[model samples]
Target: MKVSFTYDKKQVLQALRYHFLSRKEIRLMIILVNVFALGSAFLFYFKKILPLAFLVGSFLWFILMLSFWFFLPGMVYRRATTFKDHFIMTFDPDSFSVGNERGSRSYPWKAVSNFLETPHFFHLYFDSRSFFLVPKDSFSNSDEIYQMRHMLKEKIKN
Candidate 1:
């Protein structure tokens, strides 16, 4: 199966947020920070701790959320040249090829470590940090989307 695609800024940013949040460590950190912040609030309310503790905890939580929601996505948007170019991607039983004006690169299915599906894209991960963002809207129709999803499930472990 094959498809052509270009990234939309809003969609890509959302996908980046999904990518970050999908990581186990990041998710755990978010949960921990939220718990700390709420715990600080409770302590302050009960007069068991200084207001400064609550303020500091809330500030830290805010900073962490801001980095994930804005700073990180902004950095990725600026650094990613691939998002500006159009791409034609073909997926076969054994491998896949991605092409743009500059050139094309192909990789065997074994090269992919896993895949993650988000609302608007399929993140084809080469490793923990390296990945290709394939927009779901690139498919011609629902059938194409289903076929690609099926193919990825069969070809990649996760």
Candidate 2:
């Protein structure tokens, strides 16, 4: 139940984009943010809101968005860099140990609040800012994949 694999940039980017937003969701979010900003601008135009405060608020929001964009690379880079150094894996149904690494930490499936199955990995979520990404290459065949998926889903539900 153990295998070693690497994620190339293409796979990583695809996985992140797919999980972060669907095309429709991205469009909706953009529309909502613009509408809100326009409404705020209209209020400022009519002197319904303080000009300085409105300007400051908009600037802050822009800054926050930029900050998020800037920090995201660091997050992705850190994850990619230390991905090998840190132990990354999930439990194996057959062994009842880490499917990706043994003699490491043994965590019951219930400990994870949920799991995200990306194309390349099983993202086991312990909490915000913490997770283990177990690559799909761990299983050699379709049956193993089926078993592992079933076991994980069954365990994660509780």
lDDT of each: 0.94, 0.61
lDDT (tens digit, per residue) of candidate 1 on 102-157: 99999999999999889899999999999999999999898988888899999898
Clashes of 1: 1
| Candidate 2: Cα lDDT at 12 | 54
Predicted structure 2: lDDT: 0.61
| Each prediction's TM-score versus the true structure | 0.97, 0.56
The model with the greatest TM-score is: 1
Candidate 1 stretches greater than 4 Å from native = none
Worst 10 residues of 1 by lDDT: 149-158
* True-structure RMSD for candidate 2: 5.9
Q: Kindly report which residue pairs in candidate 2 clash with one another.
A: none
lDDT of 2 by residue, 84-137 (tens): 443434446533344233345677666777777877777677764466666676
Cα RMSD, model 1: 0.8
